[model samples]
Target: MTATRAIVVMGVSGSGKTSVADGLAAALGTAFIEGDSLHPAGNVEKMSRGVPLTDEDRWPWLDTIGQALAGSLDAGKSVVVSCSALKKIYRDRLRQSAGGALTFVFLKGSRDLLTARMAARHGHFMPASLLDSQLATLEDPSGEAGVVTVGIDAAVETIVARALDGLKTVG
Candidate 1:
């Protein structure tokens, strides 16, 4: 069985990445980082203005998340990260920078669910209007390396439990 050094919870906005990653980290008795917080001020500003981030805009943020993942592995602590890693390129870059030390748990759901979730949110820089762009940009993680795809809309406990189950399978 291969040991997992890090787990990345990925999905578009409002797919519950944060909640699931937090729960998974707690369950694994390790640290969890919110990938969004690592985003540069410029990226936040762009998203706040309803502008979708280009590949160039996201490189630094992705690298930052990857570094965090690598650091956790170096510390010998399991880690979980909440990130909207919507593209294969993004995931590949993250894995590369993580030094081949990460697993991905992708939360997938209907656009309607994500849109509703985005709309109900408050005090967020990402506007609901940007959801279409986000969805469009999203490339499902199917056939990607070291990835587990989990259905969205399940209870948080159920979601976390399934993630743990997946880890056992992978390990």
Candidate 2:
């Protein structure tokens, strides 16, 4: 139906959001936006120091992410956002700002998988130790009306296919 105007690749830290988002963008012939780039310097430092950011620390960043989503959708271009929208309220903000032209693909996996991924990750502000906190904060978006949940262990093709299928379903 070509109804998915934008795709938000969401999950906790080290959940493969960037890789998946980039791959999805390439598949859809759309741009990929790294949500990390929108984070303020202070936020980066806080996360890098193994400090989990509170909702107050996140609102501005989330607002910027929302703006990016809105911008891409407003231009009628499919863009994939790599973001850790771990909470329902955060997702709600993005949806509100992005209006109706947005959809979310929640990349989910086990704690062990996420922890291992985080441990192996290099040059990222988020630390492996923070994985626990992130997981604890994650509210599964499974039953959300406009959300898609893809397993992390699946092959990239399978994951993409699931996301595409989710788009069709939502459409």
Candidate 3:
């Protein structure tokens, strides 16, 4: 039998985390969490103005996301959540919330592909201009425990299948 995963779908701003996580959640029969919703107003404001966030700006937001994940896990619910999770320290902090229960799915993609996707997106506060900042901040999670890396070039269905297969293999 396959195990249920409380996963964080992590990547740069335009790496299709939302599309992939939503598909995976449906396939896995779990809750779909939009981690951007947990971001504080100040953080959103900063991003909307094309400003990069300092670590100080993210602590409260990460804490809030961690709390939500912890709450869902403690309630025995499995969820697929979307977060940039651009740094190892950020992932480490979230690990404190649920220990080994959290798996991070890294949506790896080329900058050109991601930037085009971001440019084509509508109504998101994160502008395509900030893609560089996000890419710069991202720390590869290939060596991290409980991490599944899936390329974002494929269709959403393919990405979901690959990620689920990766989870099974890693587990």
TM-score to native of every candidate shown: 0.94, 0.94, 0.96
Regions of model 3 farther than 4 Å from truth: 1-4
What digit string (tens of lDDT, one per residue) describes model 2 on residues 73-105? 788777889899999999989889999667889
Q: Among these predicted structures, which one has the highest TM-score? A: 3
Local accuracy of candidate 1 as per-residue lDDT tens digits, 16-88:
8999999998888778899999999999999999899999999999999999988878877678899999999
C-alpha RMSD for every candidate: 1.7, 1.5, 1.2
**Total colliding residue pairs, candidate 2:** 0
Please identify which of the two predictions, 2 or 3, would achieve the higher lDDT against the true structure: 3
lDDT score, residue 80, model 1? Answer: 88
Cα lDDT of candidate 1 equals 0.87
lDDT of 3 by residue, 49-122 (tens): 99999899999988888888888888888888899999999999988976667899999999999989998989
